[model samples]
Target: MKCKILPPKGLYHPVLPYKQLTSDNTHKLLFGLCRTCMNKISFKCKHIDDPTLNKHDKIHEIKRCKECKNIKNEKCIHSDEERVIVGTWSTIEIDKAIEKGYELQKIYELEHFEKTSTDIFKLYVDTFMKYKQEASGCKCDPKYCKNDCKNDKECKTKIQYIIDNTAYDLDIDKVKYNSGLRFIAKICLNNLWGHFGMRDNFTQKNIVLLLEHITKIVFNEKYKDISTMILDENIVLTEYKEKEEYSKPNPSVNVYIALFTTAHARLKLYELLDILQERVLYMDTDSCIYNDDGSEACKK
Candidate 1:
C-alpha cells in the first residue's frame, strides 16, 4: 500500500463501505483503471453488479464481468488466463492496456514508458513482496489471538511481529525487489497465502494473515502428518483459490499484465500437458516453468 512514488503516510487502499460504482468519481463506467487496475477487465460496464454503480435500474440478466482476474479488489471466477482462452477480453495487450488505462492527474501530468526488461523485473519483484506477508500470515501469543484461533486449526495471529512490535517500529530495512528473490518468495507465498491483487474480496492484511498461519503450521509441526491429512499441498484451498493468477479484471485497465500472463500461462499449461507422459503434470503450477519429465515430485 506504500507506493514508492507517493509514499503517503497511513496510505492503505481504503475500501468503499458500499459496492457502489458511482461512489468514487474514478469508479464511473468507461473511466480509466488507475484506481482499480485489475478490476478494469473483469468489471466492464456491460457486466458486474456493483450496488455502488446503480447504473442499471431495469436489468434482469447480468452482463460479463470486466475486472481483470489478477485484481484483488474486483470479483471474478476466472483468472486472466481463463478469461483469455474464453476470448472474453478486448484485443488490447499489456502495453496498450496500460497506456489506455492511464488517467493524468490534475496535479501531475502522465508519463509513458516502454515495457523494457528493467520494468518487467520491477513488476515481478513488486508483485512478489506485495504478496509475501499474505503468504506468511502472522504470529501471535496464544492468549491474545483474535482471528478465531480456537476455530482455525492453524492459529497464527501475528504477522511481521518484528516489524510492528519491535522497539524500533520506525526502524526497518526496506525489502528490495529483485527477480531472483521475488520468484522464490512468490513460489513460497503463492503455495501458502495465495495471490492478492486489484480484485474484490482481497486485502493486504488478509493475505498476510493467511501466510502467517502457513508458517505457523509448518513451524508448529502440524503438517508433519500429511500422510493422513486432507490438504491440498498446503492450505485447505477452495477450488477458486489462487495467487498471482489473472482474474477477470474490472473496467480499470491495469490488469493488462494479468491478462497477458494468464493467456500465456494457460496456453503453456495445456500445450505442455500433451507432451507430458502424465496428464496430471498439467495440473501442477510448475509445469510452465519446467517440462523435463512427468514425475509427480519433479512436476512440482
Candidate 2:
C-alpha cells in the first residue's frame, strides 16, 4: 500500500508554480541539508563563493546554496569552510526537512499531479503471497537440498520437481527456512523491481567496416565515453553511451516503480532508526544493528 498509492507519478523538475510539493504522507527518504545557513544571511554580490576554493570542481561547479543561486547572491555564509555548497536532496527529503524546521529552498523538485497506479506491484505481490502459502510448510530432501534442511514439513515430495533444479541463494533464510520451492517463489517476487530501474543509457556497440563511418562517429558530440578497438585493417568495434538529448528511455523500464519500492523500504528503516536513536551501532540500506539496552523496542 505504501509503495503503490503513495508514490507520485509524472513528477516535474524545478516543480510547477505553487503546486504545493509535500511528502507529508505520500513518501519518505533520507534527508541531509544545511540548517545553520537557513534564513541566517543574505548575499550582496553575484559571486556567492570563490571557484578556486572548490578543489573537486568537476563534481559541482557551483558551490552555493540553491537559495543563494535563486537570488544570485554573491557571498556564502555557511560556517563550515570545506562545505561551501548547501547540498541537494530528493523531493521527499526536502519536504520532510522543511517540516523539521530546516529552511532549505528547492530550485528543482520531483512533483507529481497524481498518485502511482496501485497495479504496479499487484501481480508480483499476489504471486508471492500465493506461493508463500504453498511453500509455507514445504521442506527439502537431504540428498537434493544443498543447504541444511530443517525438515519442518511432511510434504517434501510435493515440490520435489522444484528441488531438483538449482537452489536459489535468497537471504531470507533467517525469516523462514529455505527450500527450492520457496527460493523459486522468492526470485519471482524480488527480481522484477530491479529491471524497472534499468539505466536509460548503456554503452551501445557499433561495428565499423569503413574509415568514413568511424570518423563520423568519432566527431559526433552526441556520443560520449567512446571506446574503439581495431579488429583488423578495415574493421573496428566502437562502443559509446549517448548524451541525454540522443539517449532514449527503455520501453520496458519504469523508474517510478523502482524508486517507490526503495522509498517505502527506507521509510520502514527510518521508523526503526527513530526508535533506536542513539542506540544504533551500524546501519545499511537493508539492515540495522542496534543496542536495545532493554528498551523493549525490538520486542515486537
Instruction: List all candidate RMSDs to the true structure.
Output: 23.9, 12.5
Count of clashes, each model: 72, 3
* Per-prediction TM-score to the true structure, in the order listed: 0.22, 0.52
- CA displacement after TM-score superposition, residue 146 of candidate 1 (Å): 31
Against the reference, the lDDT scores of all candidates come to: 0.36, 0.54
**Model 2 clashing residue pairs (backbone):** 45-74, 47-74, 48-74
lDDT of 2: 0.54
Q: Which ten residues in a row have the lowest lDDT in candidate 2?
A: 1-10
Deviation in Å, model 1, residue 260 alpha carbon: 1.7
On residues 80-104, what C-alpha lDDT tens digit does candidate 1 reach at each position? 3332211122222222222423211
